[model samples]
Target: MQRKITPYLLVLPLTLFLGIFTYFPILSSLDLSFREWDFMSSDKPFVGLENYALLLSSRDFWNSLNVTAIFALVSVPLRLCLALMISSYLVREGIVSRLLRGALFLPSVTSAVSIAVVFSWVFSTDYGLVNGILAAVGLPRVSWMQDPQLALGVLIAVNTWKQLGYDVVIYIAALQAVPRELYDAAAVDGGRRWHVFRRVTFPLVMPTTYFLLIVSVIEAFQVFTIVDVMTRGGPAGATDVLVNMLFRIGFSLFDVGTGSALAVLLFIFLIVLALVKAHVLGRRVHYEA
Candidate 1:
């Protein structure tokens, strides 16, 4: 009895913390999704799915969902592929590899807001570094964040650059865990480099790939800070992601109920995505590596 009680006591703080901060907010959001209440209002009226109905029927909601889906679909694969390729080169233990790894990973640990702010300057049209270089080469200055056509793409590029380092680090760990015997066997069979990687390295790294796929997709969907800091989802609502839409609806417009409904929908979408990924890719993840 004493040992059991001790274990529970040790976990009580964390349990309470999660309950108060995470679980309670989730429950409140779910409840609020069905009710109409501005943040300052004391009288909360139950609207009974009206919020969800409005959210689902709104063009803004569909636009946000489409934008988020495009971001996730494009950025996740690019990040994973680029990370895997870069990590393959940086896997060896050497002074140069160590320095490169550290440099690559620095962005991951840096503040997302800070990164966005810096990138805003970097991509600015008039006095930006990129524009300066273009001018130096006698090229045109491109409006990266202002143009509706290019804003989302700029967001994707910034996000990929910021996230690539973390993915590379994870891939490096996964690559290092792979048994050398398999590569040796492939080499003994006189397999070409690409063939060896295709048959041996990739198959073994499927578990890590699957893990990163889920996480990166979720992160991409929930991305808000960069869009907020840089574009504010501007230039004809081009970069308005689901999370940014949620923020605008909930906090900016004071439409708490609708925002909560959007949040719930986003949550459900993410859950469904995870389930689909598990069903499709889970079986292919070989843990034996």
Candidate 2:
């Protein structure tokens, strides 16, 4: 009996932790989404889809959805492409390469708020480093964060800078794990570098790329702190991503039930997107490599 119980005992702590923190919250959110209540209210009246109805009809919600979609679609590809190329170069073992990887990855470990704060100054219209360089070059100062046309672009740049490090590190690991024997074989057959990479390296790295795609998409949707710190989804609501709107509704406006409904919708949207990704990309991932 002792031997049989040992495995269950070992797993019990983790199970309990998840139950308390993860599973319970998800269940609570689901329940809350169907009811109307403020955070302080004792009475949570069952509204039964009213929150969802409002969200689905709201123009702000749709705008947020569009902005989030654009952000994810644009940023994910840019980050992944740059990370892949950088990792390709940095994959070789050397002191300089290691140092560069550490430098690049510093941003990933740093606080998001800290990064946002620094970038706010960097992109500031007057005293910013970017504008200073523009002045030096005799170019007109551009409103990076203040212009409605440019605010989302600024956020995208900041986000890309912050996330590049982690993606590069993961990509480096994936590139390194690629069997060296395969490269040697390709070289023996006189495979050109670009051709060899296209035929072999790219295919082998598909699994990593697929995983990063899913994670990065989710990150893009949840990009609240940087937006809040930098633009507060402003310059005429041009940068109002979904999570920012959700936070505004839930906490800032103190609309608990509506916010929960929005959260639930976001959750469901991500789940459907993930399922679509798996269906489309899963077969292309080469686990063996």
Candidate 3:
């Protein structure tokens, strides 16, 4: 009894902290989603799923979700693949490898808002460096942010570039853990570089790939700073993601109930995805240790 009590006592502070902070806020948000509130109102009217109904019926919500899905689908795989390939290549080379690795990893450690600001200028339709280069080459200047079709792609590219560094670091670590003996055996069998990577390295790195995929999905669902700072969900809401839409509903429009509904939906969606990922993939990690 004393041993069990001691363990419970040790965790009491953490339990209390979570109850006050995490659990309370989640419960509050859940309750808030079913009611109507203007953020400063003394009285919150109980609306009973009206906010959720409105969001479900609204075209904006669907559009934002579609944009978010596209952004995540395009950015996550490209970023992870590029990172894995570049990191693996770098770890096999000499002095240039070290220099390039450091350069590539810098963006992940930098501020996202600042990076978005710089990209905003770089991607500007008029007088931007990208358009300037196109003009110099006698190509027509592309309206990057102004065009609805191109805006989401530009935002996806920015997200990929910003997140590439961290993925590279993760891939580098995974590549280093791969044994030299495996490579030697592959070479002795007359295997080319591509063959060795496909047979040995990729299989060994499957666990890391799964991890990056799950994390990228979660991160993609929470994207807001870039959309808010760069495009403001402009060009007819082309780049509006779920989080940005939530902010617009909750804060900008002062409709807490609708915002909370979106938040709850996003939270539940991510939670389900995370659980499925863990249950399905957690059992499949290749361990050589």
Candidate 4:
């Protein structure tokens, strides 16, 4: 009895913090989703799914959802693939590899706002670094953040660049943990380089890949800071992601109820996504490494 009590006591603080900061906001949002109240309003009135209905019917909501889906679908795979490739080469022990790893990881630890601001200038139209280079090469300047077609792609690139380092670090650890005996056996079996990688290295790294996949998907969906800082949902809502829309509705517009509804919907969508990924990919993950 004392042992069980002691374990529970050890986790009590964490449990309390989770309940207060995470669960409480979630429950409050759920309740708010069914009500209508601006931040300044004194009397909150229950609306019985009206906010959800409004969001479902709104063009902006659908557009935001589409943008967010595209962002996640494109960025997650790109980030993972690049990270895997980079980590494979960087797994060797040396001063250069260590230096490269630290340089790559610098962005992961940097503030998102700082990254966004720097990128905003880098991709700026009139006096941006990119345009300056293009002009120097006798090419026309291009608007990276203002064009509807290009804005979301810019956001995706920025997100992938920022997240690639963390993924590489994780994959490097996973790659290094793989048994060298497997490689020796493959070489003895006359396996080609690609064949060995396809059979042994790739399969062995599936667990790490799957973990990164889930996390990257979640991060993609919840992306807001970069979009907010760089484009603010863009010149015509081209880069308006779900979370950005939620922020606009909830905080900027002060439509607390509507914002809560969007928040709940986003939460539900992510939950469903996680469940689907678990169902589809969970079995393929090899934990033997």
- lDDT accuracy of residue 255 in candidate 4: 95
Q: Candidate 1: how many backbone clashes?
A: 0
Better of 1 and 3 by lDDT: 1
| Candidate 3, superposed: residue stretches over 4 Å from native | 1-18, 276-284
Cα lDDT, model 2, residue 145: 91
For residue 283, what is the lDDT in candidate 1?
86
TM-score: the better of candidates 2 and 3: 2
TM-score of 4: 0.97
Every model's TM-score: 0.98, 0.98, 0.92, 0.97
| lDDT (C-alpha) at residue 38 in model 3 | 91
Question: What is the C-alpha lDDT profile of model 3 across 15-115, one tens digit per residue?
Answer: 99999999999999999999999989899999998988999999999999898888888888898889988888887667888888888889888999999
lDDT of 4 by residue, 1-289 (tens): 9987999999999999999999999999999999989889799999999999999999999999999999999999999999999998999999999999999999999999999999999999999999999999999999898899999999999998998999999999999999999999999999999999899999999989999999999999999999999999987999999999999998888999999999999999999999999999999887872
Candidate 2 per-residue C-alpha lDDT over 1-289 given as tens digits, one digit per residue, 9 for 90 to 100: 9999999999999999999999999999999999988899899999999999999999999999999999999999999999999999999999999999999999988999999999999999989999999999999999999898889988998899889999999999999998999999999999999998999999989999999999999999999999999999998889999999989998999898999999999999999999999999988888981
User: On residues 1-289, what C-alpha lDDT tens digit does candidate 1 reach at each position?
Assistant: 9987999999999999999999999999999999998889899999999999898899989999998999999999999999999999999999999999999999999999999999999999999999999999999999988999999999999999999999999999999998899889989999999998899999988999999999999999999999999999888889899999999999999999999999999999999999999999988888982
Once all C-alphas are superposed, what RMSD does model 3 give against the true structure?
A: 2.2
**CA shift at 76, candidate 2, in angstroms?**
0.3
| Regions of candidate 4 where Cα sits further than 4 Å from its true position | 1-4
Worst 10 residues of 2 by lDDT: 280-289
